[model samples]
Target: MNDKPPFPGDDPFVDSPLVDSHCHLDFPDFQGDLPGLIERARRAGVTRMVTICTRLRQEPAIRAIAEAHEGVFYAAGTHPMQAAEEPMASVDQLVALSAHPKFVGIGETGLDYHYSADSAALQKESLAIHIEAARRTRLPLIIHSRDADADMADILIREHAAGAFGCVMHCYSSGAELARTALDLGFYLSMSGIAAFPRSAEIRAIFAAAPPDRVLVETDAPFLAPPPHRGKRNEPAFVAHTARVGAEVLGMSPRDFAALTSANFDRLFTKAARTAPSRSGRQE
Candidate 1:
C-alpha cells in the first residue's frame, strides 16, 4: 500500500496547482491506499478533486468521501449506461442531495449510446431528469456523452432552450460539431487523459478550438491514465500529466494552462470555490 508512484521532478508543471474535475474515488481500485493516493495527488500539484457517483444508490458513500476529505467534492446521478437497470432518479432526490455542503455538481450523467444503445430512450429520460436537477440546484451538470453526439447535442440544446443551466462535457472526445454546440451554449469541455494520447490529434484540435475560459481538466481516474503511466490504473495525481499535454496542445506554458484550467473549474464548479471554514474552524 505504501508503494506510491514517484513524483516526476522533471515535469514542467510540477509546481502548478491543478484540479481533477472528475474521478471515482470510491471505486475499489484505490481502496487499499486512499490516503496515499490523495497525498500523491497533492504532491503532483493536484489540489482538488470531485468524486462522482454514477448511480444514485451510491450517493451516500460518495458524499462521505467528500465529507471526510478537505479538498474533495461529490456529484451524484444515475449514469446513462445504467439508466435502464437502476431505479429512475427523481429531480427531488438529486436536489435533496445538493443540500449537502460538498455536493457541488449534478451528474456524470448523459447519453452513452456507445455500449448502452439499447437503453437510448431510458438514457434520455434519465439525462433530462439530471438536467432539471442541475437547473434547480444551480450546480453544473456533468455530462458523459459518447458515440451519440447528435442526440446528445439535440437534447442539450432543447433542454437548455427550455431553461438555462451550467454544464461541462466530461472526458469530451466527441466530434467537432458537439464541441461547438456545447461551447455555443456557454458550457465547458473537460480534457481527459484521452486527449493526451499521441494519436489524439483530432481531440487536441477540438480542445484547441475551444475558449480557454471554458476548458477544464480531469482524470476520469481508475481509467484513462495518460502516457508514461498509460495502461496502468489512474488516480487524481495523473491529472497533472494530462494538463501538461493540454498545455502542449494549446501552445501555452504548462503552468499557465494549469492555472487557466483551475480557474475555469472554479468558475463552473462555483460551490467548490467559496472559502469555507474547515473542521478545525480555520478558513480553507
Candidate 2:
C-alpha cells in the first residue's frame, strides 16, 4: 500500500510546480526513452516542458512529439546558426504552425555572432520574420542571443517600437546592458543551467538584478546541465538543480523562487500556461 508519487526523487520545494521553459526533447538524445524521461521530469516536479524546433522542416517531427505528450508543448523557428543554410522562414509558415493546440511559442530564434557571425545579416532577417510571426500569433518569441549584444539590443528595440511582441531571452548569458534593454521592453529573461556554473558570477549578477516576476527557468537540456551534472548529458529533470541555484541567486527559498519563475513563464508563454491542466497526471 505505497501511495506516494510514482517518480523517485523528492522535490525539496513544496507546491512549486516547475516548468522547463525550454528544452529539446525531440533531439536524438532522448529518442527511445521519451516516456521515461518525461516521467523523470514529473518526479522532479517539472510538470511542463516546451520543446523547441530549430528548423522549420523538423516541425512535423517536433509537432508529433508534442502531440504525443500531454505535458509537452513546442515552438518552431530557424535557429541563427542555421539561418544561412535553412530557407528563410516566412511569417505565414510560422503563423500557420501556431494553429496547433500544442504549439505555444514562436521561436528558439535570434542573433548569434559567436560562431555564426558570417550569417549575421541572415540571422537578423530571420529574427525579424519570427518577431512578426509572434506579433501575429500573439505568442512569445523564444530568443537565443550570443556575443551580439549591441546589435541584438538595437534590433530588438527597433522592432519593438515598430510593433509590440512578447519574448523570453532563452539561455541568456549576454551582457548586463542587453539584459536591461530586454527587461525595459517588458520581455522576460530565462535563467538556464549556465547560471549555475561556478564561474558565472557576472551572469548570476545580471539575473540577480532582474525583477523576480520577470524571470523564468529552463534546462536547454542536452546542452547546459548545470553543476553536479555539469559536463554530462542534461535532461528536463535536471532543471530543479538549476532552479535551486536560481533560488540562491535571488535570495529566495527554492519554493518561493520556483513559484515566482513559474508565474513569469505563464505571463510570457501565455498559451502554454492557459492550456496547461490543473493536476499533474492529466493531459493538457
Clashing pairs in 2: none
What is the clash count of model 1?
0
Model 2's alpha-carbon lDDT is 0.89
Q: What C-alpha lDDT, on a 0 to 100 scale, does residue 236 get in candidate 2?
A: 88
lDDT of 2 by residue, 194-268 (tens): 999999999999999999899999999889988777888789888888899999999999989988988888888
Task: Give the C-alpha miss distance for residue 55 in model 1, angstroms.
Answer: 0.7
Error at 122, model 1, angstroms: 0.4
What TM-score, over all chains together, does every model reach?
0.94, 0.95
The ten-residue window of minimal lDDT in model 2 covers: 3-12
Stretches of candidate 2 exceeding 4 Å from the true structure: 1-8, 278-280
lDDT of 1 at 109: 90
Cα miss at 65, model 2 (Å)? 1.0
Q: Rate the local accuracy (lDDT) of all candidates.
A: 0.89, 0.89
Identify the runs in model 1 with alpha carbons over 4 angstroms from their true place: 1-6, 9-12, 276-283
